[model samples]
Target: MAETRTFDVVVLGGGSGGYATALRAAQLGLTVALVEEGKLGGTCLHRGCIPTKALLHAAEVADAARESETFGVRATFDGIDMAALAAYKDGVVAGLYKGLQGLVSARGITLVEGHGKLVSPDTVEVGGERYTGRNVVLATGSYSRTLPGIEIGGRVITSEQALELDYVPRSALVLGGGVIGVEFASVWRSFGADVQVVEALDHLVPAEDLAVSKALERAFRKRGIGFTLGDRFASVAETDSGVRMTLESGKTLDAEVLLVAVGRGPRTAGLGFEEQGVRLDRGFVVVDERLHTGVGNVYATGDIVPGLQLAHRGFAQGIYVAEQIAGLEPAPIDESGIPRVTYSDPEVASVGLTEQAARERFGDDAVETLDYNLAGNGRSKILATQGFVKLVRRKDGPVVGVHLVGARVGELVGEAQLIVNWEAHPEDVAALVHAHPTQNEALGEAHLALAGKPLHAHN
Candidate 1:
């Protein structure tokens, strides 16, 4: 026996994207149903962003204790307690999950707890019951990806297993030097593990500005983290003690754990997406500027849609889709304006074009750049952090990009995003007063240097 219920919007996948879509649609006075096979808040809350950051914070605490003498604080460097650390991370996630549940419930959005499959463009079936909507949103999210012929089990693991480890390995070999790989490497190194990273690209965090990537590499090397760049992975074998990885260069590296952090693939197969006329390009939903799937009243958001794959990006897309469904005609998202932050030892944050990208788009001669060293910032000196704020702009026009690397630099991205998104000129930003001895002042100083004032920097 199957029952049919209809709503104004039926969102599949109760992750950041789907839940956000449901929340905003409900707020706009549209009836909504949110389906999930797992808990609400999805990977970002449970497996990806939230839990990983907790681990990183614990790692920071460990590093602080180990380096307390540098700050004139007498403290003993102790080992990590796996049980306590897990409990703390789990506690943080539990609190957020509870809060999200309450918010969804309060919004009067129907929360369907089951595996949902799109039986048609406007209808999803869960446990033989069909939930139909005037419009449907696909936000199935993504799963951890691994190289071909490489198995993830026993000593070989993914980020999910890495998060649930009961003991810290003496050594770890992380494949992929992107955000996930570098982050786990940072955490393990802080927890007293020797880490080696493998990247098929020339630089770590290769998608970032070349300057930021090079700075991060220097920082990692200074911290004793070894890496093999420009080499691809060939095969991995389970050893008696741990695992052994052989690179394409025929170099063999043995470690207590092999973390396959290549990337994530969209979770869009066997879910009736194509059957419902939704076009998928290499497992990602193909959508227009407004997120329409070119299908009947169907829209897709989040990792499945294949742009940034960030949880925050998913949130924004979900809100946009909801507004569009409500006929609010919200403006399309400027993908370049979205902020990106990598939460590692020396955090990397950026918005808008990179120097290379700006040069390619606006020409090298048309762009001017400035690097404001954190060495000159009062707050950076206080924290003993090393990095810089790199700004790229039109020769005499507006700031086109903002890239930052150093401790707690990710926190400064909100203002950086605003500066780039609003197309603020270096002169305009330079005129603003920033609080003295704050990290944000670094941004001001960078803008000042770019505006030809050269405060705290050589011209």
Candidate 2:
């Protein structure tokens, strides 16, 4: 016999978007049900962002141990206990999981642990139970995509296994040059593993402005990270001792472990979207500007929405959709307002239009830019991190974009996002008081230089 249930909102996939929506909706006095087969906190807390970053931080520690001499400090790292690392990762994950559960429970949100599939436009079937809601949010999230010829084995793996690796391999072949792949490469290389990255794109972090791409390549080269960019994967095969890969150029590379991190695909398979007539294209949920699926009362958000597979982006989408359903004043997501950060040794964070993008949109003469090197910045020198603060602007108004690469620069993106989205003029930012001796002060100085008021920098 089929069971039945009802709620004001049903959120499928208890990831960032789903849980956030359920909590917020319940906060608004709406009855909500959040369904998931696995533990909460989704991939970000489980195998993706959170765990991967934990491992990366471990790698950074390993690098710091090796470089303690530079700071006139003595330190030595004997070895990495896989058990200890995994336990540390698990602790971080468990703490967040507990917090999420508390949040959901305190709000009186019902959480059903089962694999949910849509039976109708507004209904989901899980554990033989039928749950219907006025608004259905499908935030199924995404999975890492592998090449057709490549099969992920114990030795050849994706980010999922890389997070839970039993032992760090002596050598690793990272098969993509995207954000995730490069990050892992940096981690592995820092951990004293031989790491090589291969990418089909012409430059690493290829989606960034070309100069940004070139700058990263230079920084990566300085760190001794080997790469084969502008090369396509021919095939992957398992050897008796290791894994081997051949590029389209007929060049071959071998390593004890192979990681495929090209990109991730929407988790839209066999979730009953087809029977419900939900639209999908290129493995992503098809949606209009409002994020509505073809089926009535069925909507999707986050990685499933198809642009910029970011957890925070999904956070915005979930809030917007819930507001739209509740007849509240809702604003469409400004996609460019979403900040992006690459967690590498030299981190990359950017928001809004790139210099070229601003130029193309507003014209060459309309766009002016100031490239401020971190060499002159006090904080960058103190942290031993090198990069630049790029300020993009129009002659008479708004700072268009800010791109950064350095240690902990991701934290500064909040200010950049505000400048870009609020349409704050360069002078407006420049005239504002920024705390002395901070990396963010560089942003203010860059703005001042762009606005024809030079302070702490020569233009």
Candidate 3:
């Protein structure tokens, strides 16, 4: 016996993208059903973003306490208490999960709990029951990806396992130098682990602008975090104590654990997506700029949509899809308008085009860039951190990109994104006074130089 239900909207895989779409659709007065095989809030809230960030904060606290002597504060740099730290991380996740659960309940959106498979364009099957809707949203998120012949077990683990470890190892070898890799490397190094990062790319966070990559590498080196760039993995052999890894560069390293911080792959298998006529490219649901799928009355959003695979990007895409389905005629999302951040030590944040990207698109002579050192920033100087803000603008037009690196610079990307998205000229931003003695003033200083009025910076 199977149950049958109908709704104005149905969202599959209640992750960041799916839940957001369902919530927005319900707010638009559409009856919505949100299906989930696991708990709500998805990876970002549950495992990926929230938990990892908690670890980073704990690491930062440890670093701050260790360096308190420099600040004239009398404090001892005690070692980490793994149990208490884990509990704190879990507490943060639990609190956010509770809030999200309450929000879903309050919205009156039907929360169906089970694995859902798209049986048709507008219908999903879960637990032998059929759920039909006028429109369907596919938001199945992503999973931790590993390379060929790389077995993840025992001492070899992914970020998921790394988060749950009750004890920190004496040494750790992190693979991949992207967001997840560098972040975990930073955390373990702070926790007193002998950390070594193996990145196949030429630099850590290779996707970021070259200058940002160089700065992060320098900071990581100063922290004594060793890394081998432009090298590929050859093999891994497990021993009683730990694992032995050999690189293609003839280098061998051993560690108590190998944290595979490689990227994530979309979780779009066995859900009957393509069988239902939904277009898919290499496991990602194919959708147009407006998020409409090839299948009639069906849409896809989030990590399943072959873009940034970021939670906030999922949030924006989910909202856009919901409004589009409601016939609201919302603007199509510009993927470039989305912001990115790497929450490692000396964080990296950016929005809009890179200087190289701008030069390619707008020509080298037509693009101007300014790099404002954090040494001139009172807040950064007080924090005893080093980095810079790099801004890219059209020769005689608007600001097109903003890149920042240093402590707490991730918080400033909000204003950076606004400048890029709003197409404001350098003078437009320079005219607005940022409060003095703040790291945000570093951004203002970059714009001032770009606007021909160098302030607190060498012209």
Candidate 4:
């Protein structure tokens, strides 16, 4: 029999949410046990966010070199060095993982290196050892999902395999045109691969605002990225050379590799969650607004929860849960206020309700929208990026949504989130100053137009 342990909080799966909960709970002077089957920083640090973003950055650098003549630096456009790129991406992940390990150690949190399962609401069993705590947080994170009858191996792959590929394919077919799909497609295209995306939806990044999606589609088309929208994937077969895919509409396509980027599903199965009396909806842990499972002090956060599967969202929920356990009574998280970004070239970033959603909820008469073209912004012109900042607000009321599509637009989501979360009126945002000759100025310009004081744009 293994020895038993006790802590104030026992967090299962040391992914973003699990480690974050342990760190914050320990900061509040609570004894914490963070269990993991793998590395501490979890998928985000090792596989998902960090490594993927590093790839995107590399793609950006490739694009810069390929288009350097536009900037008049007289640089030669060379192909990507896969070995060096892998090394660079791995270096970034390794540095962050090391720092996270150091932080966990310094915080005096017990790092249990094993797969943990909830034997009871308050007890987690790992390696035949029981760790009991007053509170337990489930944050097992997520895994890449595949379609029915479509196995991921060899020529057919998911984002995980795509990230670690030794060589870019001559041509690739990406299934699903959502965030992950479009991002991978963008990276491959910039790396000089002939990339074609097939989305079941009508547009790329369909979850984003319609205008933003349309803009992204146009940009992708201009970049020579081929896509077949509104087409459902029927089947895929591995060929001697690559993959051959057939759509539900009886269309056939072939590529050197087929990337199945149909998004991710929460990793919760056979881990004793249901046996422990925690409720689950379609494999997602059911939690209240406070993230509590309503099953004996057990809570769920991150991808395990049914909301946004963003790493940052997971981090925020972990902190909230820790504070709640410490009697801080933190306010519940607002799902819509969370920022969303797709890190493809000509990235899309948004916060709050999308224009269509806002109108659907508040009625068309209650909603008004303004689109400020980035073409009018000096910085955008300099970057040679074409897109817009769109603002959606209640007629004569607060700004309800902010959507942006352009190069480096993801960085502007912080302010957009602040505006929507605070329910700031268009006039309120317009009253503030945005520095000239910056992509950020496009946001301010949109607000100014919405506030009925257009600058650098037509009213």
Candidate 5:
């Protein structure tokens, strides 16, 4: 016997996308039911984004303390206290979780706690109870993926296990040179681990602008973090202490631990989505521009929807879907219009097209760029970080792309995104004065150079 319940909207999963959809739907005067089998904030809050950032920040604090003498500060650099750091990170998560719970409760969104399986296009079944809604949302999110013939146990672990480490390994071999791989590699290197990154691609963070990849490699090298570029990972075997990896170049590397920083796959297995006529490509839910599925009133968002796989992107998509279901007819989101940031050492942030991408899209003759060095930025110089701001634009038109690399550069991406989204011309950005002696001035300086003003730059 199954209990029956009904709502105006039913959201599957309680992650970033799911929660956002539920919240927005409830706010729109829809009775929403949010179902979850785990903690609410999902991977970003519990494991992925929040905890990793806390670790990165801890690493930052350690680096700052270790290099305090350069800043004329008399401070002794001590090793990390893993227990305290974990507590601080967990505390931040807990407080935020409490706030989120309060928010959902106040909005009158029904919080159904269980694993939900879509029994029909309009119904989700959990614990032998049926929850029905006029509209259904699938936001099951994703899980860290492992490669074929790769076993994740003991010393070989994914990002989930890496986030909960009680002690940093003495040496680490990280597979994949993308965002997750580079981020963990950066954190480990900062924590005094002998790290070697293996990327099958040509460079680390390969999806970013090539200049950014080169800059990151340079920075990591200067920090003594070793990596193999333009090589393929052939095989890996568990050793007595850790693991041994062989590359296609016939090079063998050993480390105390091997981190599989490959990537994530949508967690859509056995959820009954396909059984309900919802289309799926591989494991990802198929959705159109409006986030609607093949089944009537069924929609999908977040990592399961086969786009950016970013939490913020999930939030945006979720809100958009909610509004769409409410008949608000919200404007569709352009996938490429989203901002992306890699929170590694000498962080990489970008919005709009890459340099090569811009050239391809608008043609090489139409695309022009200016690279503004951080050496010209007083704040960056004071911070003793090295990198640059590279802006791409049409030869005589608006800025098309902005790429940034250096310490704390991720914080400046908001303005860069606005410039790209609004299609502001170099002259338009150049006319505006950024506050002096700030890293943000790097963006302004790049625009100045692009506009042929060439302040603080060699043209």
Candidate 6:
């Protein structure tokens, strides 16, 4: 005889999406049980987003100290204590994890710590305990993917190890110049590392607009960071002093460390989706418009599902699924409404379509763009930032996109997302008064220019 724990909802993985689902479901008066093999808050809170951002902030502070002379202050610093920095980062992540645990507990969600796999359509096995649920949600999250023969080790590292390193290396090579790669490269470059970015693509951040990619290339070049765009890494060999990576371009880059920032993949293996008849698509758990799989009463969300792999996006999806289960007609999630932000020195953010994509879909004449340089803005001038705000609109339709590249531009993503999701027109925003000399004013001015009413900007 075995003990059977039953619930209205059983969320597997307990990561951002799972925990959020459990909490929201519990709040909706449904009994929820969350099963997790690792820590409660998942990668974003423990290892991925939270810790990496904190370490990057520390690197940014060190860089700021070096530039203090420009502000008429002589700010000197000793070398960065990597161990102490790791401890501080750990404390920050731990505190957030505690807070998440408190929330889950307060919501009356049962926390089950163990590895879980689907036993049946509405049943999961955790630590040899079979639990049945009225509904099941999968939120296993993802892991760092590496290239073949590129094993992660002491010198050959991934972003995971890069975050826990004892000290910043003097020289390093970052493989993959995507969001994560550029972010770490920016951090190391600011910390005085001779950082080189090896991107197989022809440009950095290949997903962004060509103009934005060129802007970052120019910005990195001005800052002395090296780039080997359109080059691929053949292999990594460790030497007595450091590690060396042979590039497909017949060149070898030697550095104290090599950080692999290729990308992440869903944690779908060994979870028994195949055995349970839960459909999968290209290694990710497949879900329909309702986020339900073939398995009756079973659902999935977050990185495991086939969509954008953002923590906030995962949060929204989880809450929506819970509300839907509670018989609430929560509006379907629009993936385009999710904003993407790269926290490099000059952050890049985009919501909705790109200029090229918009033109292709709506024809050349139907698409309009307003590129407003940051130098003309009072807020950017105060920070000495170089970049612009780009507004993309259909000639006769609503505004469709907002792309940005500049200092602190990531903060503008909230408004950009709202405009894109709400289908707000340029005139709609331009008509509204924006506070003067603020970063948001730059957006408003760009919108005004797009609406054919140029104000405080060159036409």
Best-performing candidate as measured by lDDT: 1
Clashes of 5: 0
> What is candidate 4's local distance difference test score?
0.92
lDDT of 4 by residue, 377-443 (tens): 8999999998888898999999999999999999999999999999999989889999987898888
lDDT of 1 by residue, 1-459 (tens): 567999999999999999999999999999999999999999999999999999999999999999999989999877999999999999999999999999999999999999999999999999999999999999999999998989889999999999999999999999999999999999999999999999999999999999999999999999999999999999999889899999999999999999999999999999999998899999999999999999999999999987898999999999999999999999999999999999999999999999999999999899999898999989999999999999999999999999999999999999999999999999999999999989999999889888889756534
Give the whole-model CA lDDT for all candidates, comma-separated.
0.95, 0.87, 0.92, 0.92, 0.91, 0.88
Model 3 misplaced regions, further than 4 Å = none
Give candidate 1 misplaced runs (Cα > 4 Å).
none
Inter-residue clash pairs, candidate 1 = none
- The CA lDDT at 17 in model 5 is 96
Model 3 Cα lDDT, one tens digit per residue, 1-459:
577799989999888899899889988989999999999999999888999999999999999999999999989877999999989999999999999999889999999999999998889999899999999999989999998878999999999999999988999999999999999999999999999999998999988889999999999999999999999999898988999999998899999999988899989999998888888888888888889887889999899898797999999988998898888999999999899998999999999998889999998899988899999889999999999999988989998889999999999999999999999999999999999889999988888888999956434
Q: Residue 319, candidate 4: how far off, in angstroms? A: 0.2
Deviation (Å) of 121 in candidate 4: 1.2
lDDT (tens digit, per residue) of candidate 5 on 1-459: 666888989999999999999999999999999999999999999989998998899889989989999999999877888899899999989999999999999999999999999998899999999999999999999999988867898888999999888998999999989999999999998899999999988899988899999999999999999999888878889888889998889999999999998889999999999899888898999888888997889999999998787999999998999999899999999887799999988899999899999999989899998788898889999999999999989888989889999999999999999999999999899899999889998888888888889866545
Please list all clashing residue pairs in model 6, or write none if there are none.
Answer: 82-166
Per-candidate TM vs. native? Answer: 0.99, 0.97, 0.98, 0.99, 0.98, 0.97
Model 2 alpha-carbon drift over 4 Å, by segment: none
The superposed Cα distance between candidate 1 and the true structure at residue 457, in angstroms, equals: 3.1
Off by over 4 Å in 5: none
Candidate 6 off by > 4 Å:
none
lDDT value for candidate 6? 0.88
Better of 1 and 3 by lDDT: 1
